[model samples]
Target chain A: MTLHIAVLVVLLGLFFVLPAYHVGAFSRIMVLAIYAMGYNLLFGYTGLLSLGHAMFFAAGMYGFGLTVNLFGFSVAPAFLTGIIAAAALALIVGYLALRTAGVAFMIVTLMFAQTVYLVILYFGEYTRGDEGFVVQQAQRSFAGIDLTGETERYFAALILFAICFLAVAKLVQMPFGKRLVAIRENEERARMLGYDAAKLKLHALIISGAVSGIAGATYGLLFGYVGASFSTVQYSIFPLLWVLLGGAGTTIGPLIGVIFMFYLIDISSGYTDAYLLIAGVALVLLTLFAPLGLVGTLRKRAFPWLP
Target chain B: MLASLEGAVISAILVLTAMGLSIVFGVMRVVNVAHGEFFMLGAVLAWVVTTTLGGHPVFGFVAALIVVPVLVGCIAAGADRLILKRVNYDPDRTIVATIGMLYIIQQATLMTYGPEARPVEAPFNTRLSLPWFEFGDEGFQMIWPWGLSITSYKLFVIFAAIAVLIALWIVLTRTKIGLIMRATQQDSDTAQAFGVPVGKVYSWVFGLGAGLAALGAVLVVPIQQAHYLMGGDPLLLAFIVVIIGGLGSLPGTVIAALLIGMSDGIISVFFSPTLAKIIATFLVAMVLVFRPQGLLGRAPS
Candidate 1:
């Protein structure tokens, strides 16, 4: 664990010190990694494959942006507001969607997420509809730092990502995390064992939503823009791809997956417009040949205690 | 009266598309997320055939109708053998694989056909003004209702959907292949033990399902322009209908399609399209909560 942290620290340090090559781009990846990790909490650890995490993420972005725009809130306060709104949104969506199991759950979440998107698009006055909203400048940062500056934004994203990652790590070691795993493995069995499986799943969903919301807030802050595109069904599926690619149920796997995919898209888009073809083919091939993804594959073949 | 007629047309299209999805889910237990892409491909095929022949629109449309569904069916069958067979129909994994398939097919179309929306000229497009009846002292008065007109091609679509559905019913009930499919759907292992070629049946089912969806696209593309990205909405709508009708229930799927289609048509006509979508999606969520088995769906054992 310490070794992994040591490596992450050095890697982040390089990004911070070295010439700031596309720092915004790297910041985007960090934000996405944070989003993916939040998704992994529900999908990987708790075994709930939600199709509407985008709703939570977008809720965070729009919520935070709205607070800043309307209420004149600063960075951290607006970010908190955005995340709390996302968690609340998750509570409602999850409660409604979790009524059914398996495929029903996936489809229900999908429909609800899409419905939220329609609502957002319909209420264009607030969301700006297709026009989208420009994120207000964060007037204040933590302890006298200027968040509006580009380099400062990168550090803010990096710091938030680390905090969320560590929080996940600590939580997964506790009894609550063990209960989540139990629910994931066999909800029926867990219920038979007297666990409040639904409540536990709900909690996991809220935490996951909150984390994803924070990532969305960070993304809005870093990019200074928010759009309905982020809440699309495509974006909902995007995190699933990242989690699957990284090997679900692992802390480092999502980060690895995000890094690889981010660069994959970045590099491939330069070569051809059909780079999505590669991502598509990769998804099919991976599901067929490498269902466990990078971390799971390594755990099976080499370092067995990877998670 | 015009709204109801339009609703019937919409229901016809929905029935055609959702039946294919229900059949595929029932027999193969794989939700082909790429199913909508087949519909898009069918429309593209229709456009290609129509434009290339460049003679009488009727002649070109006929050629497209005959060739497009079969071609799409073959493609689907090939996909089944190569990809789905390899994946072995694990629901979650198959979902992702089909999403990949969706992106592949969509991008392939975009690359080949370009990103422009292509219009298919209807073979016959004589507009017919619908007559409305109002209750009066004379029991009923035939009155022209506010200049509501429909194209002949749309009427053909309504008839074609019904004919195709009836033919499908005969095939499923009266034909040997249909019997094979139903038996396989009911219990694959049992059917296999009884000398049914379950693998062949699956491929045939997948092809038939895609072919049906393609046929719907072919019928409707003349009215609505065919584009690479147009597959997503139909796919989502079909899934909503299929899920509500209960996965793998043909009659349930058909009924659900009619309900959704009629409502969608009428709502969009009277209210906003976006509101119609919201209502439909909300209904799906409600069904999932209140009655997961759907209107006519059989309960899982």
Candidate 2:
């Protein structure tokens, strides 16, 4: 618990102070960590592999983008709208997808996500297609604060992440979280025990979707734009990688994975522009040998006395 | 008339890709997400051979039909032996590992070929017009003085795909190796206990599926051209086919492929392409909800 608190404090401090050291890299890492945590809840804890997480994430971005740019809504409402839109979308999609389990579920959800992506891509008149959406300076302010500025955006993102992290931590300790674990362990048994497996999965999906939505909304607000690329299949896989790399089923694992991946990519993009190859190799190795993930590995090593 | 032929041609192309995915999933129970990457590799290889080796494009195509699958098959076999075999039937880990493999293969291709799309020259480009077909001031016209017209390349694709399907059916049903593969699909442990070399059978099945995908790649190059990312689209389409066909059901896959292919082609022709995809995906999701086993798939035992 102390370790967790310490890590949280350090992360919060980094979010506030990192802009002084380096603006773009630090902010990017923070957003990615938040995104990974959302993914970790669904994949790591719930054992549901969602290949289309970017759909929810992009939903937030587009929701914020549309409300702010086209409808001229305030930033707070835009962010809330993005989260609501993503949650609603997740509810519908999850209701359908969670009906089936295993590979069928993964493919179905992914296809649905890809379908949305195609719609966004081809409906050029609305989405601007590949060109993407740009946010105006006037649109970036929340009351008196200028969100367009990096420091303000970073702080805004930090607040959202802190709230989401607390909510997830609390939820995971509740009875609902135990049911999720039961569902993950043995779906048939869970169903036989009178647990509404589908409903539980849907709950997790919605929570996962809501968190991802916030991440996406934050991304758009901070970056001051959104685009079709944000919702592509590549983006869908990003969270999965983070979950696996950091350690699925562990709270801190995803954050670690996201930070590591972000830094790795930032550094690698400078050298050969083949960050994907490196990431892929790392993922394969981790999946093969360290399936418990980084935190799981640490737990095993440090707690040799307990077991 | 030409529209019908066009539909037939497109259906044939989709079937080729779908069948390979079906076979791999059906036999090995490993969803080869990288299957489409093999197809892309085939197209790229054909282009390289034809352009560089100074041969007929058909010869290059044939070479790709053999070489690309063999190369990818070896990699897949290694993946199965080194990683997948350990995980066995654990779908979650297997899916993640395969996804990891997908990224590795995709990035490798990108690294080698770069991100730009490349074109492969078709061996034959001539259009074959039937004497019976004709069109007038009306929106449409038909046969016998306005009969059917088709591209020679499309006809070739249809013929090639049919031939491959026939060959696959024969291999799966008539051969001893095919029997072993069928047995393994039915029950891996029982097949092994019954003296089937389960390991070798898996490698062979993976190779066979990869080869079929490569064949699809070679056939479609004339129409779609070759590119690094060409595989991603087909991969998604194949996944839909597998789901609708029912897992491990070969005949079911064939029917599902035709259904989806025709639906996609016809719907896209009539409506916006984006709307067509959304509709198709929606239909699949509905089917999954109501009948998870698919059109012809038996209930999971």
Candidate 3:
């Protein structure tokens, strides 16, 4: 817990010390890390590999985006609406998807996400189809504080990240989180021990979805744009890649993964237009040499007390 | 009637693409997310070959039909040897690796091919008018209907797919190679114990799977323009077909392809294309929820 707080303190200090460009980048990475963290909840701890998490992220984004854009809802209510939308989506998706396991689960989530994407496109009048609408600068304020200001946005993102980070850290140490890990390790054995695997998984998914929703809502609110691109299969894959890279089942792995990936792309984009090529090659290499990921490898080799 | 014809064409292409995915999945037990990229590569390579040949469209088309699949097969085999083999084909690792491969292939194509959708001229695109049968007072009269014609190339594609599928069926059931493949698929460790080169077989199967996707793309390029992004839809549709058909079942893949392709065509006639896709995607999810093993797939042991 002291280590976690120290890490937060360092992040807080970095905002003051770092240049403008990096501060902005750090803000974005912190928000995305939250998404990756949410993904890690189910994928890392629960051992459920979903290929359609973008829907939850989009659920929050579009929920917040649509409510604010269409209904003229304020930021606070719109954010709540976004989280609610994602949780609801997670409920429906989880109910249907949980019926299948393994590769079927992956495929089911993928198809559902595709359906959600298509539905968004079908209602182009509201969504503007592929070209998304932007939230007005005037409407994006929380309790009279302007979120568009760089310093304010960075602090806002940091606060949200700290809350989620600490909550997830605390949650994983509890029995419920341990049970989730137990399910991940061996679902059959966990069930035999009288734990309701189905209900546990459902609850995990909902919490995962709701957290992802919060990230999604915060991302749109802070960045001031909501687009359908967030719901693509590519987007779904991002968290998986991040979780895998950082170290699954680790509290801080998602942050590390997001920071590494964000910068890898950011740095590579300076040299070439095909920056994703670098990401692709990095993934292949990571799988080849470091399949356990950075934090995973660290835990294996050096620090056994990483969490 | 027109919808059915269009559906048949789509089914023909889908069968080839999905069969490749199914075969690889059945034998290797790994999903190649890069399969569609292979399909896109086939069309792109076909374009490059045709543009360079600078002769009759037929010559380039035939050469591409013969060469692109082989070329793509080699690439896929190389990838298997380099990356997949190193990972030991662990399912999760394979997925991540293939997704990496997907990005690599897509980005490379984007860099080289650019974003424009390029067309490959059909070797033979003469429209063949169809005669519709009418039951009237005159009794059993045949009338030629306007705009109810298909390009000869489309008919050729249908025939070619049938021939390939038949050839595939024979190779899988009647030949020694087929027996060895089946043996490997049934139990790789046992097959290896029996002196089968399982590693070599894996490489070959990956190549063959990719070759089949390439073949499908080659055939479809003239009907639909060759674009780097064209692979996405086919990949999704192939996944739906493969799952609906019961994973790696060949016959099931074909039947499901037909069902999906036909329904997609028919649905588009009544609903907007996006709406049709929405319905199809939702239905597939429900099907998986209800029957995870799929229509013809055996229950997991």
Candidate 4:
């Protein structure tokens, strides 16, 4: 844990002080890390692989961006609304999704996610469809800090990531977290043990959704853009890959996964336009050979307390 | 009438693809997410062959019809050996693996064919007019519908799908290989005990499923145009059909495809295309909620 904090401090220094640090990329990594953290709670720990978390993420982005851009709301209010919107969406999608299990859940969530994407696209006049929407007032000062300032944006994302990391860490250690694990291990057994598996799964979904929303809002703020693109299956897969690649159920695994993938993509993007092909190949290889992912495999093979 | 005809054409295309998907699901219990990429491959291959031939459209199309599916089947068979076997058809893992395959195929196509949507010239496009009788001031007057006329190619597509499906039915029923496949599908361990080559059967099944998708793509590319991105909609539609129709039931698959096809045609023409998609996607959620076993699937004991 101390090591984790030390790493965070060094990252903060790089973002705030180091001239060589790419704040834009760091900010993106932090935002996605938060998203992956939320995803891990459901997928890694709870063992529910939702292929439609993009809906919640998109909801958060659109909620935050639209509120700030259209309703003239301040940053704090918009941020809260984004999380709320995502949690609320999770409530609806989770309720509907929990009616099924396994593959059905995956397909149902995917279909519903596509539904959301189509809805957003149909309302292109408002959301700007394929072209996407830019938040003109995204640079507006919030809490006496200039959000337009690179360091300020980076710090904002970093602080959010820290809170999320702590929250996920604490949540997984609680009794509720144990219940999530039990459900993941065996839902029928958990149910026989008098635990409400459905309710617990729903709780995990809601928490994950809200965290993803927070990440999405941060992404919009840092980049000043949000669009229907976020609602696609591709976006949902990003977090899944990150969680799986880094290590699901491990708090620091998500950060490691997101950072590693981001850097890999960044470096390779210059060489080939088929960078997505690389990502695809990596996913297949990892799923086939390294199911436990980088951190999970390492912990199992050698270091028990790698995280 | 025209809307329903359009629906039939769409359903024909769907059946060609979804049957392969359903067979894979039935035999291996793996939901191949990259199944749509086969459809894209079919169209791309067809485009390559037809464009390369560059002479009589009929000759070029006929060559594509024969060659594209065989080529796609070989690729899928190779993939099954290389990747699916390693994963051992683990349901969840296969989904991700197939998704990865989807991207690899999509990006490879983008690199090779570029990003442009290309049209394949139809062998023949003779538009036949339909006569409609309307009561005017003088009474019943016969008039030919203008845009209601459809090219003969669409009719050929519907007929072609029917023929292929019939051939598939025959192969599954009359052939010894079909018996082996059925045995493998029913009980893999027992089939293996009986000296049936389960691995070879799996590769063949995967190839067959991919071939169906390719066949459908080759038939439809004349109307829809060929693009690397065109596979997504067909893939999603195939999933809905396979799920709703009952994953291993070929008859059920055809029935559900027809239902969705007709509805897609009527709804998109009268309402809006987006509305049709919304309703269809929404229906999938409902189907999962109320009837997870699907329409024709046997209930689990």
Q: What is the lDDT of residue A201 in candidate 3?
A: 98
Look at candidate 4 and give me any clashing residue pairs: B20-B209
Which candidate should be chosen as best, given lDDT against the real structure? Answer: 3
The CA lDDT of each predicted structure is 0.87, 0.79, 0.94, 0.89
TM-score of each: 0.96, 0.93, 0.98, 0.95
- Model 2 chain B weakest lDDT span, ten residues long: B139-148
Interface RMSD, all candidates in order, equals 1.2, 1.7, 1.1, 1.0
- The runs of at least 3 residues in candidate 1 whose Cα sits more than 4 Å from the true structure, single-residue gaps closed, are A16-19, A138-142, B130-148
Model 4 chain B, poorest ten-residue lDDT window?
A: B263-272
* Cα shift from native, residue B232, model 2 (Å): 1.2
RMSD of 2: 3.2
lDDT of 4 by residue, A27-115 (tens): 87899999999999999999999899899899899888888888888888988899999999999999999898888899999988899
Regions more than 4 Å wrong, model 2: A15-23, A192-194, A303-307, B133-148
lDDT of 1 at B178: 87
Query: In order, what is each prediction's RMSD in angstroms?
Result: 2.0, 3.2, 1.3, 2.1
TM-score of chain A of 3: 0.99
lDDT of 2 by residue, B1-301 (tens): 5666777777787787788788788888788777788778777776676677667776766666666667756766777777777776467777777777777877888888788777776777777877663567774675544345677888888887889889878988999878888899989999999999998888777777766777778777778878888888788788788788887788888888788776666687888877887788777767776678888899987
Looking at candidate 4, what is the lDDT of residue B211?
94
Candidate 4 TM-score, true structure as reference:
0.95
Summarize candidate 3's per-residue lDDT along A24-100 as a digit string, tens digits: 99999999999999999999999999999999999999999999999999999999999999999999899889988
